[model samples]
Target: MRQIQAIALVLILGGLGYALWVLYSQPPLQLSAGQADHVSTQTAPLAPVKAATDVTLSAINTLPAPTTTADAPDLTPVSRLPEVNDEETYIPPISPSVAAPAYHGDLSDHQAYLVHQSAQITQLKQDYIAAVDKKVARLESLLEKGIRHQLPAEQLQEARDKIQGLRAMQAQLRHELAQ
Candidate 1:
């Protein structure tokens, strides 16, 4: 073991020494003042490359330059728009047709409508609660199955989290109902 370790240490040192020697032996790179940061594509025409690909690329086709005619409409330069002051701005009153219709029903009629709306809202809450309960039940069953069949921790955790969220939602709904 000691011999192997000594051999490995010597090899590592020798490799490092050889690398340093090679690096120091190389000539330092120097850039001339006129040297460009990027290679110019103009000097090397792309025609040869196109020929290699068996695609003949002649002079690039360019769109014809636009020509102005004496018949063209005269275009006037845009001038600064007149400054608008807040006080000068007038907003017309909302049209009667666009305004909300005024409540013309009697007090008792309005009360009865309010009661009906409240009942509808309560019914919606109850329906949502029932749906949440169903989901919680399904998730609980899945959790039980996961535990029984030794499902992956991720799937089990996901089922548990969903059950928790549904329960929290149910609790919130119950709280609101109590209020």
Candidate 2:
């Protein structure tokens, strides 16, 4: 019965696909007469080209030439220019007093602050490790309870995997703490 139904479904789908292909595969139909006329009337005619003649050439040549009189600046080559003296555009060095403020902080106090921040970071790592240990313990307990209660094997396996991952994370954190 299922085979008969499947064969009929395939035939129906094949007919539908063939119909769609026939509908879309052909070139578009010709436009209506009014649309054709509108398209033809909308096209613009090309402009005529101008012919070049001796008169046009002469007009182009008759433009005024540029003047080279005293009003124009000299165009000396760069290699021929004179060297500039340092004194002519001198910038004085900044005074030591003005630049020394940035280096004035106490290094020992900054060292102590950095040491305190390192202690805080270490404490946070330890706290995270403790949390992970708690999670591992809870997951282990759940796994044991699930086994005793005859829970689904998949659920028991998932609990086991989660506990293993949490223990691995704790081990990594402990290693980092040792560093």
Candidate 3:
């Protein structure tokens, strides 16, 4: 029991010594000499100067006075003027109007033209779709009969070129129709 008590006292003394060493031996937070001087100068207040006074009224009254004029031009109203007709005025023709087309009764001629163009566009679309279907069918038939491989390379390239040309033409027609 005495040995254990002695060991406990030694540990307590060691811990207290370590605590004191840590408290005193560590370096303190520090600022440079220039920084310390800057802080002190910044905290100081400036000296006050003498306040200014208002100008005297007698100094302003001694200046030159402006002259008044009585010979200013008169602004009298003018008399009413007579109305004048100008020859340059444009007047539309009142008689002998040209007759419009029979198909363009109340509807505008442009609108009729647009409707006709729309019908033509529809027909073109149908024709293009039919042509595309025919080409697709021909391609499928050639594929099924295995004749695509049997044909010469040049002939096969030409067939592909023809289909591509037809597609391009169809696209151009569609673009025109859209416009």
Candidate 4:
């Protein structure tokens, strides 16, 4: 075993030494700046690189150039805006045809009604969760007793039905609460 290990260690050391010698034997890469780029696309598949100052971009290439204030066009006087010669002649604009709520009273009332409904929904959800907990406890106790000894079929079926009903109610209540 020692001989085999010694042979492996010698071979590994020799290989590493050979690799190091070969690495240092080669000349360093010499890049003459002129020959680095010769405008020949066939030599490399990479896109041609350009110096920052070498590229020129016009404003219209991607988006239109912004117009000066002097080049602005006059707007057509189609809107019947009231010209105010007197300071106190201003009147607020109103449209009566649209039956929008004129004030925030209706919105506030709707918000309050929703809040009250949500409180009731929360109460119902808690009640249903409690009912499910009771059913689960009852079912667990029935199962444990059935497992330990023989239980009546009618009693087991009753427990299962109770659990199913409780689960359904719980699921419905959860859905309502999520909404």
Candidate 5:
């Protein structure tokens, strides 16, 4: 019995030792100098290079100039073009008699109404967010205490329904304001 137990312990220790040795004896990953330089250069911002401006041109002798034809027509005089007097022109000026539609009363009243509605909607959104936060906190607390399994199916469904209703209300308010 003692010999069997000793052999079993030695086998287990040997297996563990072999596993640790294998894990530690892995080859050290190495990068070549060129590869290392490439990686480093890729990570670094590129510096702008100045372009070479000293251009060389081929050496050549002066060529003969092209000849012009004698049959070409002469250019016309500028003063011969048609002209118009300033008094003969008819340019219309803008008149203040053309009145623009007033929106001071109607626009201001509608804007004030929308502002009041928006304030109420904002308050509702805040309330919804608070309710959501409270629900999330309760869910998290239940999860942490491992009491999620104790929650009734109907209670869970009710919570989901409430969340959906709040989201729908928020969407409707946003759509109304957009219009």
Candidate 6:
């Protein structure tokens, strides 16, 4: 059944394609007699050649010469890919190894501000890391002594959970800062 359906579909498509080809591949539509007459009358028929003498060598010589630069159209550049030459030398670019720029001019306002903000951000990050480290150390110390100091089991567990949370937050912060 599927094979029959597939064959039917192929036949239908082929028939449609053939129909389209027959429609389009034929000559342009026929015009009315009046329209045909109007078109034929409008177009001047070429004169019958009596001899090749109409196109003489002297007539060719009398024709105006091709225009030079001044009269010609502005030669706009046509953007096309450069043709590769097999014989041309291909010098590999130098790797960015240590050559510093000669211009040591004063920094623009934006550049200076960027440098200042970067330093400020670095300092702020350092301050944050120091604070987190202190908190983590304090928590660890507390956890170590929680049982000896007669802290309740629930309280110790809560403290332990808090330390884990803080450590995770610290790790996340570090990851963000690294990025």
Best by lDDT: 2
Give the alpha carbon lDDT tens digit for every residue of 1-179 in model 4: 99999999999999999999999999987767666664343376855658988766667754756888689787666676645556434355686665422333346698776776667669768877877886688677766766666778877777778778888888888887778
Residue 147's lDDT in candidate 1: 99
TM-score order, best first, reads 1, 2, 4, 6, 3, 5
- Overlapping backbone residue pairs in candidate 4 total 0
Please report how far candidate 3 places residue 47 from its true position, in Å.
99
Task: Compose the digit string of candidate 1's lDDT tens values, residues 1-179.
Answer: 99999999999999999999999999987756455432343255553454466776455544445567775677654665555667735466685554433445566797877876777778778878888976687678768967997999999998888888888888898899999
List TM-score per model, in order.
0.35, 0.34, 0.30, 0.33, 0.24, 0.32
Model 3 per-residue lDDT at 42: 76
Q: How displaced is residue 117 in candidate 1, in Å?
A: 2.4
- Model 3 per-residue lDDT tens digits across residues 12-97: 99999999999889898698999999688778895554454543336565465654455545545466553444652335559986
Q: What is the lDDT of candidate 2?
A: 0.77
Over 1-179, each residue of candidate 2 has an lDDT whose tens digit, in order, gives: 99999999999999999999999999987999999886786685745557655233346644657776776788898999977666543465586653212333457798766776777778778888989966787677767867987999999989988888888888888999987
Best by TM-score: 1
Summing lDDT over every window of 10 consecutive residues in candidate 6, give the lowest-scoring window. Answer: 98-107
Question: Compared with the true structure, what per-residue lDDT tens digits does model 5 show for residues 17-85?
Answer: 999999899987699999999788669885565675654443553344455666546756678865655
Which residue pairs collide, candidate 6? Answer: none
Each prediction's total of clashing residue pairs, residues at least 3 apart in sequence or on different chains, is 0, 0, 0, 0, 0, 0
Candidate 6 lDDT over residue span 1-179, tens digit each: 99999999999999999999999999997999999997887796856877887764447754678899899997656566555556543455698775433334355777866776676666666667668877778777777767787888999999889888877877776877788
TM-score of 4: 0.33
Clash pairs of candidate 3?
none
Residue pairs in collision within model 4: none
Record all residue pairs in model 5 with backbone atoms less than 3 Å apart, i.e. clashing: none
- What's the C-alpha lDDT at position 51 in model 6? 82
Tell me the TM-score of model 1: 0.35
